[model samples]
Target: MSRRTFSVVVLDSLLSLATKLQSGPMPEPRVRTAGATRGRLWRILMVAGVLAALGGAALVVTVLIRTPEGSAGRPETAAGLPGPPIPPAGTDAVEPSAVPTTRPVPTLTLPSSVATSASSRPPTTSPSAGRGSSTPESAVVPLTARYTTSSVTAGLLGYHLDVTITNPAPRAHTDWRLVVTLPRSTLSVSGVSGATATQDGAAWTFTPDDTTSRVAPRASVTVSFNVNGATLLNAAPTDCQIDNTPCTT
Candidate 1:
């Protein structure tokens, strides 16, 4: 062989060897890339599994918490615990006849006297003056008087009399003399004498010179007088007056 052809063949052989080395597989780089890709996929799958397990555990807890006990319909006692008691039947009720009844009581009343009075003298003259004497205008005059009976029993033997006398004048009345004449049908006088009498002739007067009577202005006098029951029952008066003028009955 020629020397130049041999040199050319050796150089061509070296260049072909270099090209084959470069084209061959690199195991370290390929392995590293594959492992990194697999690791990322595994981490993603692990995260998904953890989220699903947490969601399932939460749903289970919610169901358990919402459930209620089965024995909630029982009755409770005052002590806050369950109890059983049988109520009384209709036979235990009370009947109308078992109740008690009450009665009303009546009240009684007795007879009482309403009013009484007495008087003496002529209708127009003062009892202190004689029949022909001239009387001053300011002198107190004594005149015929009357009395009335009230609230008296028809046939009562004894009773009480409430006498009220009112003074109408502005001045206080320091003395009063009253003579009460009883009817002949009810009372009888024992003493017999010729007495001074007025023209009316229906009544008599007995004046006692020892006692004095008086009344105050704009005031009233209430007195309890005692008289014979038989006389008053038979000789009840119908009218009352003071000094020949009509007074309260």
Candidate 2:
């Protein structure tokens, strides 16, 4: 108990006490402050969780409102439903098939005389008519003319005729003549050339041209003449001659 020593001893005791206090349990004020801070943090976390849940609910409601009610019956979008099949190349789209129909045909017949004559005769020539009269020129040699008449016109008396000259010889003929006699009063000549004409009573004579008178063998030339007669005269001649030779008479 000296004064300085006593004071020093008391100071040491105070220091030990402060150290003990620091190492001991927390003070009431600090613990309360910490509790208050923890409470505030917990409240903030709960509020954030609630807000997130509300936002999720709002999104679900929007989706439900946007979806169409009728879409349920149609094919599903996300289920990967298949589309209509495509048609094969060059083929038409599938459709119902159709039925078919059918039909028939016809025929013809000919006369017996024509059939028999046609069959018996040679294809190119006429049959001999009688005995021994040296086969007529047509039977001796086959002669043909392309046409018997040259020029034709439609008229009141129908049509007129001309003479056709045919050269049945193998060589070309330089001279040709045709003499046609008809009743002069019954007919009138509208045009004539390179011909000599004369009349004897009702009959007239026509002498053919000698200048341009040339025809090739197996070929023919036509000379026209005017005629006045029946309307049926417009028909073409069935018999024709080659040179002086008659193919058919």
Candidate 3:
């Protein structure tokens, strides 16, 4: 039974017994029997004992129901229950977020001077020497030179003649000579650089200098001099030869 209900029943029983005892006339000292007296006293003592036991039991039950298990006088949760266990401070329950991936940076750099020289230079092709009727018709001349003339005036005197010789051959020429003949015989000639210059009156011949190495293919060398005391005529050199073969200027 509920604590309130039990308490009310005990209170009502005590009040009723008190009222009966208080209202009933004093048991006549002469008329009252010993057995009856004993019986009445026993009844009162039994009722008091029963009330005390029931009240104590009601208090115990109330305390047990009102106080939660394991609470130990502490405050309870919203649902009147304990909370779930939490992870430790350094626990792995929470993982770090993944780092964002980054693309590598591209670089744009200019080529070095040496690299530029190497790559910018034209590629060389091997030459086919020795004449052969069996050779392909598309075969090109092994050696060739390009000639251009530039004149510098010396006022009333002759002009300066500049000769530029180029080797278009695919292979290097170890020993080479350039021969040029002038139509007029009056002009004087000086020696040339990068080559030894010799003149036989109007005929001029230039040979590679002993100190110089072989002439590289596709290389150009220039020789120039001032021609004085005569008006230079026919600046173009004729009958030019490279190595042993006649070269097309």
**Each prediction's whole-model lDDT (CA):** 0.46, 0.53, 0.61
Could you tell me every candidate's TM-score relative to the true structure? 0.28, 0.29, 0.36
Would you list the clashing residue pairs of candidate 2?
Answer: 166-243
Return the lDDT, model 3, position 53.
61
Q: In model 1, what are the clashing residue pairs, if there are any? A: 119-179, 175-213, 176-213
Would you list the clashing residue pairs of candidate 3?
none
lDDT of candidate 2 over 1-249, digit per residue (tens): 544433345445555655565467543333445787776676567556655655665565566556644665666454777766889899989776776555555666679998898899976865676644453444433334342333354555545565555666555666443434333345545455445556554444445467435566667666555555553453343333444554332
lDDT of 3 by residue, 1-249 (tens): 545544456556666765676576645334356867776776677668756765776676677667654657565566667796678888768667898799889987766987899999999965566744444544543544444444556234655555566656555656667676665567666635666778887777777676433656667666555555555445445555554556454
TM-score of 3: 0.36
List candidate 2 segments past 4 Å from native: 1-158, 183-185, 193-196, 201-204, 228-249
Residue 198 in model 3: lDDT: 82
Predict model 3's lDDT versus the native. 0.61
For TM-score, candidate 2 versus 3, the one ahead is 3
> Higher TM-score: candidate 1 or 2?
2
Which ten-residue region of model 3 has the weakest summed lDDT?
Answer: 132-141
Write candidate 1's Cα lDDT for 9-58 as tens digits. 54555555545544664233235567877766765675566556555555
Candidate with the larger lDDT of 2 and 3: 3
Candidate 1: worst-modelled 10 consecutive residues by lDDT: 191-200
